[model samples]
Each structure stands twice: as structure tokens, then as C-alpha cells.
Target: MMSLYLLNTKNTYTVAALMEIAKELGKEDWDFSQNPCDGNPNWVTPTGNLSQSKNVVICTCAHNDSCHVVNITLMRQDLTGVLPPSLAKLPSIKVINLAFNYLNGTIPNEWASTKLEFISLSGNRLSGSIPTFLSNITTLGYLSLENNLFSGKVPAELGQLKNLYLL
Candidate 1:
């Protein structure tokens, strides 16, 4: 697997460009196909006094032309500010696991376009209604929005995701 430091260098450490580097990285052979934090106990980010800006690591490595499957996981970090809406532009995005952070904002409507299989946004300060557009993604399997300050009823449109196993 490519190291985070390496990814930073290759992409000039910008959030938008990192996705492209990640896609290229995926072209190479690697043992870990899923998010790196999946099997480790320390995968969870620690709370309290974490770096304010040192939060998320979003890697988008979806290949152009092909149906890219970008894998993203932001475990334990001190991420702040609104999530960049441009993230939804990555067509190959599949898994998005972001648990235990200080993200405060609304879930972007654009996220509905990605045919995501796993999406976890637990333990954050996110508010507002869960976008009904999420139902547009039919491939969603795992979804979690617990422990957030989100108000409003869960959109019934999400019921259309037949593959969802977790909420």
C-alpha cells in the first residue's frame, strides 16, 4: 500500500488532487483492497486535543473511462470545517467511512450521485436533514449517521437502497 506521506508528496497535499493520485495508486498491485483501518483496533481516531487541521485523509483513485471504485476511509482524526462538496465529483467513489471527527455541516446533495456501498458519518456535529437525494444511489449497502446533531426526519427516499445492510 502507498503511504500517506507518499500520497501527499505526489499530490502536493491538496484534497482535490489527492483523489487522482489515489486512482493511479489503485492501478498498482496491493494487498489491501479495502480501507486500511478495517482490521486494526487502533484504527479509531482518538478524541480530545487532536490537531484541528490534521483530520481527514480522502483518497480518490477512480480510474477515468473505466467504472472506478474509489475507496475512502477517514477514521479517527481532528477534522474540522465543512466537508468539501467537490468530493462528490469523484465518480468512482464507493466506500466512505468517516467516524469520530468534528465535522460540522450538512451532508451534500451531490453525494447522492456516487454509487457508494459503505458510508459511515457517525460521531460528528453534522446538522440538517439527510438529503433525499441519497436514495438515488442504488448500490449503497452500509450506512451510518448515528451520534450526530442532524435534525429532521430520515428521508423515506433512502428506503430505495435495496442493498443497504446497516443504517
Candidate 2:
């Protein structure tokens, strides 16, 4: 029963980030009138279960009495635009997948400080060498940048990620 206002401050920021994403991607089907978590059925997974929704998933922290976004998946949605830096504002986000879209731009440097575990931007038009700061994310385990326009040698710094199993 999480409402937009009831979510934590970080979650509110994530909502704004999502708005920017929807706008940039030309997601005309995005419904702004409904609560992002409860209103959009298309945002949910085909399994017909709320918890399994592919578009957005909310996680609750009972110890802190707060709710936050943990994952965002927008695969093959025909989205276009630069990856917004606002996405880095989701304090509790662990996974981000925007593969198979038309997005282009260097991955935002602001994301270097996040606690993400998985990031995938494959099959897009993104350019620029992979950020070295990505190696700083100790929690990162999966990263995908294939089929893009990136240049430069793979950073040896990426070898620093002890938990990273994929590139």
C-alpha cells in the first residue's frame, strides 16, 4: 500500500527521475495520473503478480519505516534520449536495465557513487569510454555495454571489482 507521498525522500527523487526518463524516451503510453507502483498494469510483469512486475519494483524497509525503489527495467521499449543523471538519485537502487532501446550518451558519471549491483545498457547508441568510477562500486556484479559506440581500451581498473563476474 505504498503511495507516492508515503514513499521516502529518495523514492520521491526516483519518481522524478522516472518522469524524466519517460519524457526523454517518448513513452507516450506512460500514465502520469496513476501511482507508478500501483496504477500501470503494463508496468507489471506478465506473470500477473504485483511483486514480479518488470517495469518497477518497490521494496520496503521495516526497520526504517520507509519504502524505496530497488529495480527498474525498460527493455525493448523503443526509448530514445540521453541517460539522465537523475537516475543516480535513487539511493536504494540495485539494478538498472535499459537495453535494446535508442538511448545515446556517455553513461553519467554521477552514477559512480551509487550502490548498484547490476547495470545493462546494451544494444543502444551510447558513446564514450566506460567510466573508471564503475570499478568503485563494490556491489556491482553484472555490467553490459556490448553493441554500443564506446571507444578506448577497457579500463584495467575494472579488474578491481572483486564481485564483478560479467562485463
Candidate 3:
């Protein structure tokens, strides 16, 4: 016999993290209408819909019925303020593009542990040294820290990524 693991419950961490992200970005009305996977076909008790929400997208998990946030693209929204550290809670996130905005402050150190493959923070007003932890994300293939106020030398560890093609 084979063992199986399923996640029937909602991803509360991602929900809370999104709430914090909206609050931090000054878009308090972004969306909290319901759980991301509330009314999906896989759920035992489906209710509500995710399509009503704007500026948000989700990806369903394969081994489980639950959904996880995979991308957050708020490019050129004129958004201001710093990124909340809470965003790291979304373990499944892959792409985070907040480019062409007025956001400032340092990149949250908490993001160093994410499974991010693409990160585009270009055309912003962010200032500070790029966190060394970024080089630790082996999944990272594309990085765009250009057009910012980042100081210090690039981490040598980034060269270790075999999949990375863009910078």
C-alpha cells in the first residue's frame, strides 16, 4: 500500500500574509472576500469565488486540494511604502514583480528564505545593501535589482546558481 498526504484545509498563512501586503501597500481594499480556494471543485464544501478579486492570482497544489499564492505582480501601480516581511509566509511563491513603483526602504531580510525564481524590483526607490540570503535561493533564475539605490557588492554566491540566466 502507498501513503498519501492531502491538504484539505485553507492556506491561512498565505491569506494573512496577503492581508499584510495589502495593508503595507496602502491597498486595503485589494481583497479578503474569502479564502483563495473557497469554492474550488476539489474542496469538500465550496463557497464564494476567487475570480472577483483583482490584482491577485493563485496556483493549486498538486499533491493537495489546497491552493497557494505563486505570483504577485503589481508593476507600475504607483504603489508606495516598503514590502512587508510577512510575504515570506507564502512558501509557494515563485515570482514577485513590484517594478516601476515608488516603493522605498530595504528589501525585507525575511525574503531570503523564499523559493522565488524571478524577482523584479527595478524602477523603484529602494535603498540598502542587497541581502546576502538572496544567493541562497537556488531556485532563483532571474533577478532585477537595477534602477535602485542598493549599495555594496553583489554576493558571489549568486554565481553558483546553474539555472540563473538573467540578472
Q: Which candidate should be chosen as best, given TM-score against the real structure?
A: 2
- Using all chains and alpha carbons, the TM-scores for the candidates as numbered come to 0.62, 0.81, 0.77
Scored by CA lDDT, what does every candidate get? Answer: 0.59, 0.75, 0.72
lDDT tens string, model 2, 1-167?
Answer: 22233345645665677676666666656555455555356554555654422455445465664556678787777778877677677788898888888899899888888899999999999998988988888899999999999999889999989999999
Of the candidates numbered 1 and 2, which has the greater TM-score value?
2
Q: What order do candidates take by lDDT, descending?
A: 2, 3, 1
Superposed model 2: Cα runs more than 4 Å off: 1-11, 48-58, 61-65
Better of 1 and 2 by lDDT: 2
Model 1 quality (TM-score): 0.62
The full ranking of all candidates by TM-score, starting with the best, is: 2, 3, 1
Candidate achieving higher lDDT, 1 or 3:
3
TM-score of 2: 0.81
Candidate 3 regions off by >4 Å? 1-8, 34-56, 61-64
Per-residue CA lDDT of model 3 for 26-51, tens digit only, reads: 65434355444443332212235434
Answer with 1 or 3, whichever has the higher TM-score: 3
Best by lDDT: 2
